[model samples]
Target chain A: MIQTLEQISTIAEMRVHIKEARRQGKTIGMVPTMGYLHEGHLSLARAAKENCDVVVMSIFVNPLQFGPNEDFERYPRDIERDRELARSAGVDFLFTPEVSEMYPKPMLTNVSVSHVTELLCGKSRPGHFDGVATVVTKLFQIVQPDYAFFGQKDAQQVAVVSQMVADLSMPVQIVPCPIVREADGLAMSSRNVYLTPEEREEALVLSRSLKQAEAWLYEGVALRDIQERMIAMISEMPLAAIEYVEVLRYPDLVPVEQPTPGESIIVALAVRFGKTRLIDNLITSI
Target chain B: MIQTLEQISTIAEMRVHIKEARRQGKTIGMVPTMGYLHEGHLSLARAAKENCDVVVMSIFVNPLQFGPNEDFERYPRDIERDRELARSAGVDFLFTPEVSEMYPKPMLTNVSVSHVTELLCGKSRPGHFDGVATVVTKLFQIVQPDYAFFGQKDAQQVAVVSQMVADLSMPVQIVPCPIVREADGLAMSSRNVYLTPEEREEALVLSRSLKQAEAWLYEGVALRDIQERMIAMISEMPLAAIEYVEVLRYPDLVPVEQPTPGESIIVALAVRFGKTRLIDNLITSI
Candidate 1:
């Protein structure tokens, strides 16, 4: 029988519930998120559910991942609404841990992956990947899922997380899912709620710039030219401040010096509109 | 039915065997060691056997934890003897992966615990705890055991590892076993095999010095006096070279400036005899 969506707030309860599921020979799939659910997050949930018998989603607004000046205090959170949305999406378990529960005392341990963390979004938001890596380490241990799903919108995150899992010999398979965007082309994000209508219109430029880069790649333009064109297109929008623009090799995140006749590379960008930072990217074989 | 000890040298094979054990509703206990059969290692295996339905001992001589100057190449290894001893001690599965298997590529991930790593052994061995923390993290993931056993002989190691597990919220219970010593009171270590017969006799000073501190504590000696007297005793042994002698509080390695009437503190010491460096410690209530 399919059970009702179960809410677990403590580590002990989550472990017990997961063990019971495992005993029944059920495969666990986890979707870790920060609680203000959107279609993108739901897509990750659906991907996990499709791949495994049980779906466990973590709803934690991790304080460690937020910078001192960032919106940690004001980050969106609505558990009642989130719970309803998670159930409607067929989530079997929702793990929502308090900050105190996640960090009873200050965390003294850090999990860091080198090289990839030194570029792009990492340059703008220092220590962000470290926080993400550490919390994800904790979540992986807490759930012990057979598979964990991540959205492709955060290209750097997928790369860094893949490095951690490989280096640590973690047994779970990290499956990357397609990014679910709005009908208009803007990427889905919890921070999207922070955007005003004008800000939202400007946010569309983040994806549009990537679309332009894709066209340039198809035309066999120089890698440098592609990067410059993408930057200029975003620069044309007064509200969008380009944090970084790079046409890079896939998986490794190394900058491609020149586009080869036919080579797979990731074109990634991060832009800020006022205080809200948005990131978007797509992979293409040029 | 009790099974004969099964040995695996690959991560894939070990995971499959462990999962099969878990499916039978057996709790797993892991004892990680470098290859060398000794009474100390056997004690860890016995402790795991007593508490768990299945005991897995991983014998990987992690090159990452050894400094270039330290004993990575010359570290004692006797897998045949280790296998025989492990079986007699009730280890059900022995995971002995190659160095290549553990690190097929240069590792890019590091798991480190701060504060606790700054004192005691960490001072002498730069990047040693980071190496230890990283490999232990890998071992824990590879085995995913219910309990991971450690010997209390390495007090600082126990403290640092406990910090990593707590900070990362790892699910395994870290079971610290009593320090198994030789009939003459020397702590058991694979490096003990490196001691020349004459140097082995001289190495007894490491434990003797700590025992001297215990007597001084009973005599109501001040902490400074106890430290000085222990140092003096080890210094008297011409072959024993004192690396460090610290009387510090438990959990945190803070120096106990003075001996209170009834406080527990760790009396840890490290000494070198020729090329072999040995360490030992005792915790006592004063």
Candidate 2:
């Protein structure tokens, strides 16, 4: 039997519950997501459940993170389905605040991380990471969680958040979980549902190119050579339009001319299959 | 008898103490300041003492808030003197993190309040509020105070911080204390020490002009006329070089043509007496 999960729609109510739990010596964990739960999101929830006495899962389809022409309106959301899944995953409280609830007035405040945000999805989407950073900062304050879980599917996001936590001296610990994947090896994303059958087939190259890049790294190939090959292979796909295929130093996202021994490297890629965009990455050390 | 206040210079050490205080159910109040404690700062600490079980005062002159041409190096510092003052004021902890301790790395993350920071001292100091907001944010995270205190002398700063707290849903209450002043009616500031004795006497015009402005408001003067009159009064002082003298809506700092019966208005001014710049303001309800 699925347990009934408590749903909180306002930050005030969630804070009260969190405060009570905190007073009772219960360790709190949080998972912040833009709804439409996938295996990747569930993995984060499971991690929170395993580690925390109380787990809070917030499903806010943040409009701030999307660009003017991007998928803000079309971002997938299923509240009932999310509620059931969160209950099954042992979320003690599911905070689902409306856009108005989160942003009661015009938000003049912004939290942004430079350098780390200038590349990857941040480059393609202006003000995206600033929105993500601001909302995540708000959630961190609202939830006041001891630990927060995030999937490594968005490696750059994890890096940005980690930098923020370190820079701000925020008390919460960031736990980056491994990316979950489909049976066909495509990285699980909420946007994956937007892909057509043929588009989905074409999108698999994102993950495939990362795998190829990883193999090249193991074979002692140069970083530039691996990036070129990955781009070449992905470009061969009729529908794939490459956004960026980069091999950079991990966490910092600085350009790495050559990977040194024991230094971590991330081979990340973003591509568009027709109108739908997909991203995938692999982390390895030389 | 003066009690010895614990001085914390590192974020990690501060957090340990804050966490323990929190666990003990002691309400924490913080007074963040740029050292060289004056009556203004002590007033905030005393207010914290009155309201909280534990009072933590931080005395770091944040370099981030200082512009290239600003007096970062000569800001002011007397650790031993500040310690005695804080102890006498009933502060439990006095955080005095060094520049290196507070900013071990070049901070890439910035917290900014946009529209609110476009005027007043924020206008004169280009990245001033961003630096203030960012450092205050870091301190809030480190101290996790139940209440943070600020003096209304820095009225725009109070407004910016209040806006950030409300917008981000930070769980700390911002308590704005009444402006503390010298017997001569000069606003207490660390930088007041920078003034020569002659300049100090000339600085009296700032408060006097503000008084004139307040009187004009009561006599049914238009906002513009009152502002112009205040400017003219300050300009009469041979030593006073006015940077700005204006009347605007309180907190939001938007322009006001005329004061409505219930509207709060702020008559704020910034001026230079030789090389020393000073700011003073008065808040009044029409």
Candidate with maximal TM-score? 2
Candidate 1 TM-score versus the reference: 0.97
Name the best candidate (by DockQ): 2
Model 2 C-alpha lDDT per residue in residues A142-243, reported as the tens digit of each score? 999999999898999999999999999899999999999999899999999998998999888888888888888989999999989998999889988999
Top model number, lDDT:
2
Per-candidate iRMSD: 0.7, 0.5
User: Per-residue alpha-carbon lDDT of model 2 for B204-266, expressed as tens digits?
Assistant: 988888888888899999989888888888888899898888789988999978878888999
What proportion of the real contacts between chains A and B does each prediction keep?
Answer: 0.92, 0.83
Per-residue accuracy of model 1 over A1-286 as CA lDDT, tens digit each: 5547999999989999988998998999999999899998888888887889999999999988888998999998999999999987889999999999999998999998888888887778899999999999999999999999999998889999999999999989999888889999999988998888898997888888888888888888888998888888899888888889988887778886776756668999888898888888998786
Model 1 alpha-carbon miss at residue A57, Å: 0.6
Summing lDDT over every window of 10 consecutive residues in candidate 2 chain A, give the lowest-scoring window.
A1-10
Clashing pairs for model 1 are: none
Q: Candidate 2: deviation at residue B200, Å?
A: 1.1
Which of the CAPRI classes, incorrect, acceptable, medium or high, describes model 2? high
lDDT value, candidate 2, whole model = 0.92
Task: Let me know the DockQ for model 1.
Answer: 0.89
